[model samples]
Target: MQPAPDRLSDRRFAAIAHFVEGSVGIKLPPSKRIMVEGRLRRRVRALGLSGLDDYAAHLFDRGALGAEAEHLVDCVTTNKTDFFREPAHFDFLRGTAVPRLVGQRTDRTLKVWSSASSIGAEAYTIAMVLQDMVAAGARFHFSVLGTDVSRPVLEQARAAVYAEAMVEPVPAAMRQRYLMPSRAAGDARVRIVPELRRLVQFHSLNLMDPSYPFDRDVDVIFCRNVLIYFDAPTQAAVVERLAGHLRPGGYLILGHSESMAGNGLPGLTSILPTIYRREA
Candidate 1:
């Protein structure tokens, strides 16, 4: 006889939801139950658990899920990203931010952090822009740090490969300068050119942490599209943390849909649709 089909019950869903929010700061409301169930069923099968309820029980079973916490966080988090997903932000960085940095700073080293970089696309995009600036006589050596909560995406981001279709938004000149066609048999992919790849570093980061692990303030931070997944309070907390990682007068770029209207964050002034600056 076949095994019984797993059903993610309301109670079980609530438990999983609580775990996710508490662990990662993502708000998975009741409406996401179905989506959560669909994504988590793979975990159930992989672990050879009896069903969704069993999986939930295991998760809460007195530290039984110890090291599995990272995996659970990975399974629940969304890692959707693309090269130049939001073009305007890149344009702003290239045109406004870089120029100001180059003219103002006596030091020629520029640092940028993509706080929620999904698969390295955004970081690499920043790299390409900086490279273009360097080619055009900008006197700065750029460094980009791409961070995410998901280990899988961080690995992918470090690998720096993407499907051809995903590279569509990358400008032709940039595609030529920074991407190399994958030569792997039957794989129509492109890898970030080594020069650009060397400019970026990837690491795992959980936004829920009380503080970030950075030792130096960066010139710019790209944290777009991540705040929407968090509740208002979480959004505010995260924005505050991100702001602390920026230098005075540095820029903070959020998603177009996210706002700091009630965040009570001090020292950040709105500059554009979703752009803010740390008061110098």
Candidate 2:
């Protein structure tokens, strides 16, 4: 099959960028136009469309817009993740948050939300930390909810399989305990152990929604490495919504590079670097 020709023009770039920003709150700047074109070419070819222009038209045509917007979000959004990408967050969870939750709560049900859980690594990391806590005789019920804007990445997260390189950050003991060597694929890959997978759930979520559908209060929300893609206002708005989703006294964790310094999000007090607590 012949390759689909590049048809992303300045107008098409603007159109695609606008759709993604409006749909998912990811800001695609002018510098990302080339990256957008490159990433979207695969989608065009996969759909057997004539070119990017045709793909854009197909995306916008009538009833297909809603469904295709999901595909576009999957295409343009980046899903770069790995196990234990940030170690400090896990340390905080183990040393500070878990102890606090277990000591403070009577019911001992701990709920964590991985707000942008691309590929499930972050969610699984949270699970591992909780599992460790349980292993050390801290009696508490815990679960992780991993949500992302891209369905494809959510599917990958649900699968819970990873190549060796992706699992390299996982500690040796964790690799032996929480992951199993895969013989089915006959490759250097591993699957998250069944127990851990059971504790984590993945869902397709758009942060732009007026209200999130979480039924219960979340104890900790990890919206890391995602707000950087959005403009400051969008970041503030997302932070606000995440704050709302938290239980009073719950925590909100952001990427180290993201700053809410001047955002002045109400009801949130910065307790640590990149960590905020919702006021009771």
Candidate 3:
């Protein structure tokens, strides 16, 4: 009367793989099928479903597809990031990009976008760098915006609190200046200082969407480590959209392992490791 459990699981995995690949261009291999199952098992149990089959049917039938889809995408997407994860890029920004941009434009204000900013480390790192530059008499105005597709991570970013382990790599002096030591009610955790928190903003953004909402073009965009999850066509589309949001001579930073070599974005050139710049 009922389908076998393994058969149902296979069906569900197929459906999920299809949904994810279609929505975000992530190809989940058979090895990761168990990963998907493990992550969603709690959801299935919470919904009081018998197995993956029933859950998959419910997802399609009850219009719970959107939420379930988001959960799947969030689980598979890696968020391995830390403060100053790649120091050299920040160094380049400070020593080269910032000075050049400041020289080209007398106005001291600059806007930066962290396009796939997971839990805000990349964005906050940018803020710290900008603050240091300002302290060194650069006299530049800076605003950092971090965006991601996951609502849960975005909420965490807005909170600006990180576990003790996450802040360990942060320089002692920068930690003293940018973070406050405190213990959560039950857990001992250090949180970012209010001053640094005020410097960055977080929002939910879907890169695949056709439109972006920004009044002024951004001066720099850190879209690091995100393109690997996207297919070629999607990656090209995203690069084009990101390029459109940049001012002339603006910068686009990708993950160290990523390349836009064949993407055909004419005005952009690879200036540094995984960093591209727009023609002035």
Candidate 4:
């Protein structure tokens, strides 16, 4: 009988689950065994291994994990993203937050961080808002920083290209202004304009880290949607760390579903259901 190449032995699944949860704080319960096995196949091919069994052997018996773990983590990280996702946040950012942040700023450039910025959508969305603010004569310069744990997504974010369908949520006017449609015939794709691209930067960061390697005085941080994957303790620690990065009176915006994020956390005021302001 041909081997079931994608299947993982129960022992191998436990080991992989432990490693994944420890390294990245993402749970890989027994229910996720199928998902993890499927995702690990990418690394199996990348390493020229025969199958998941061989991949597990390579990681455990051969001790190849230290060198290959990043690739392994990249495969498993969920990077669901879209342009202008959760439009209400952007509306609040533009209509209320920016003006207030500007009013309180001492620096010329407002720094915006998209923590967990999968493929740059959230960060670029922020850049578009700030650019529009300046274009509409709101007096302040702005720069956006996009950070994610996955190296592959950061590379894609830096590339600044997307399928046309992926950009559908971007309004028509912003599309015309900020996206350069692919010139190649029949290529239904677009790349963000260089001007907007220049305003945003992508970096690799793990929210599980003890400390983030970035500025502490960020004006606003969009850490939406990514926290739900973590256990409660991890979520709280990450939230506190993110709060530490905010300037006093700066904002930390969680996803709509994460409205309870800052509950009982110090120096944070729940300004909106999911929006918390750091104490000044």
Tell me each candidate's RMSD, in Å, in order: 2.0, 2.6, 2.9, 1.3
Q: Could you tell me every candidate's TM-score relative to the true structure?
A: 0.94, 0.93, 0.91, 0.96
1 or 4: which has the higher TM-score?
4
lDDT of 4 by residue, 160-200 (tens): 99999999988899999999999999999999999999999
Q: Candidate 2's residue-wise lDDT over 91-192, tens digit each?
A: 988999878877877979999999999999999989998898898898999989999988888998999988888888988988899998888766888899
lDDT of each: 0.86, 0.85, 0.81, 0.90
Tell me the TM-score of model 1: 0.94
Q: Which clashing pairs does model 3 show?
A: none
Lowest-sum lDDT 10-residue window in model 1: 256-265
Global fold similarity of model 3 (TM-score): 0.91
Clashing pairs in 1: none
Answer with 2 or 4, whichever has the higher lDDT. Answer: 4
Score candidate 4 by lDDT: 0.90
In candidate 3, stretches whose alpha carbon ends up further than 4 angstroms from where it belongs are 1-8, 183-186, 261-263
What residue pairs are clashing in model 4?
A: none
Predicted candidate 1 versus true structure: per-residue lDDT over 1-280, tens digit per residue: 9976667778878877888899888888988877888888898899998778888888886465767788887888888888887788988998999888778868878899999998998899889988998998878898999999998899999999899999999999999999999788989899998888988999888999998898457899988888888888888888888888888878889888885632347989888868888886
